[model samples]
Target: MNADLIIAGAGPAGLFSAVQAAENNENKKIIILEKNSSAGKKLLISGSGQCNLTHAGDISQFFDHYGENYNFLMGPLYTFDNHQLMKFFKDRGIKFRKARGGKIFPESNKASDILNVLLKEAKARGIKIIYNTPVENVKYKTGRFKIKTADKIYKSKYFLLAAGGKSFPRTGSTGDGFQIASSLGHNIIEPQPALAPVIIKNYQFKMLSGISLKNKEVSLWRKENLIKSWSGDLLLTHQGLSGPGIINYSRYMQKGDIIKVMLLNYSKEELENNLLKKIEREGKLNLLNLLIKFPIAQRLIEKILEIAEIDGSQNAAHLTRQERKEIIEIFSNLEFKIKSLANFNQSMVTKGGIDLSEINPQNMESRIISNFFAAGEVLDIDGDTGGYNLQAAFSTAFLAGSELKERL
Candidate 1:
């Protein structure tokens, strides 16, 4: 079989790219090969089935969520930003709602609705979609690309590898794109788990499993050096911590790293001053009662007191200065040793893939092979939770699709 463009993987990037490329040049024969039974398997599970389509904000603000490779996304995002993305869906009769932190979602709150829009658009463009047809190998020679699948060999003038990352193997994103790109001479970065939970060593907050703290400060420390800090809501799980705050920062963490959580809003000196004022104002009150005034849960406070070796029954007036300092330190800087990060099966996205340096940021075309392109998590571009990663996929795919004619 021959086509003007042969796109591997029918995920977000492949679907969007096929539709966009068809729209740009309707004369071209575009086909998308999907390994799964249907398209958008990963999309169906994104945002817990609600599907955070894109974030509503300035393009510059969206750049920060991508970390160090923020500049590489400038071209793609600016070309087809979140605003354009929302508009595309809205024009297709998809109603959207903006939730907290500017996350945009379909009003129906179903991921299937988002997939339906992409499928509808692709179908309208007369794009051929081959389901359950996984491409086994790809070869480029004489300016034509040959793709080998289970039943037959396919040829295309332009090839797009949008098979996604290895985060969710069950969804069919088993790092096949990485292997295909590597075979084509593109460098692949070591893929790691991202947007996943971290395990705590000997977790003391197990009793407070369901307790969730909002607007708390979580910091990552490596051997006494503060690496990074994030402020958001954190949930105390039975094994460790799991929440937007902890999961967002888990990308930079590893086993044996230190996670310091600030249970109180006040600084160390401010906390000590407040404790001293409490001792003076309520001298007859017990230590536990005095400590309960903070925003933290009572059980957590009790654990802190126990860790400090301070008797909760002791009156505030009877507490020594050393005991007061210990309490202050516990509240201002609670530390936990990280045991390990959740594996890819539980991760939202894969951290590493094809290194961004080897790809043309303007169009997402491979620097090593002309007419070969890539997008989505297959590249070394993972973002913080809240619709950032999906936007990257769309933006990069749009750019690559728009430039498909030039390569052809």
Candidate 2:
């Protein structure tokens, strides 16, 4: 098979790139080869099927989510930002809404709608999509690229390796792109699970599973030094913690690290002052009852008391100065020993892939090989949980697609 451009993997990046290429160069033949039976399998499950497409905020602030690789994406993100993304869908008659934390979602509340829009655009542009065709190997020589599938050798003027990262293996993102890029002289970073839940060592909060706290702060600490911290709603899982706040910081955590959860957003001094005020007003109230008066859940209050080795039935008046200080300390600095992070099966995205230094960030093309390009999680750039990663995929694909003819 011969085409102007052959894009591997029909996920968001590949599909978006095809659409862009087809729209810009009307006579160009664009083909997307997908390993899955259908396209957008992982996208369909994003945001629990609601599909948080992009974040709604200042374009400059978007760079902060990618950490050290922020500068590498500055060009792509500025070229096609979240506003342009929303406008692109809006122009196509796809209605969307902004939710809490600036998360943009389809107004219909279905991920299928987002996928359908991309599919509709690709169809309208006459882009060809081949399903269940995985590229086994990629070769580049004499300015033309040869992509080898199971039963065919497809040649293209330009190639895009968008097979995605190792996360969500069942969805077809099994790190195939890493090998393809590696074969072409691109450095592949050791892939690790990011945006995943963390298991606690001897988790005592199993009884508090299903309990969720809003506006709580979670901090990662290593050897008495604070590594990173995030503030958001937290969910207590059977094994440990799972929520935006925990998942956002899990990428930087390792085994034996400490997770400090601040149940209440209060300093030790503030908690002590509050406890003094409560004692003055409700001196006859039981210690457990006094704790339950706080904004925390009743089950968590019981658990905290249990950890502090305090009798819940004892009145606040019976508490000694040391016991009061301990109670205050627990509420301000609840700690959990890190057991391990959940594997790729449960991860939202992969942390590492094709190293950023191996690709031209401005055009999304391979630095070592001509006519070879990549985008999305296939690269080492992974963002936070709030639609930043998807935005990166779309932005990088846009830049790559726009530069296809120039690459040829």
lDDT (0 to 1) per candidate: 0.90, 0.89
Candidate 2 regions with alpha-carbon error over 4 angstroms: 405-408
lDDT of 2 by residue, 14-70 (tens): 999888778756677889999999999999999999999999999999987886778
In model 1, the runs with Cα more than 4 Å from the true position are 405-408
Clashes of 1: 0
TM-score of each: 0.96, 0.96
**Highest TM-score: which candidate?**
1
Candidate 2 backbone collisions, by pair = none
In candidate 1, the residue pairs with backbone N, CA or C atoms under 3 Å apart (3 or more residues apart, or in different chains) clash, namely none
Clashes of each: 0, 0
Model 1, 1-408: lDDT tens per residue? 999999998999999988888885767789999999999999999999999999888888988788677888999999999999989888999999999988999999999998999999998888999999998999999989999999999998799999999898999989899999999998888999998888899887788888888999888998888888889888889889889988877779989899888888899988888888888999899989987987778988887788778999989899998888888787888888999998899889998899899999999888888889998989999898999999999999999988885554
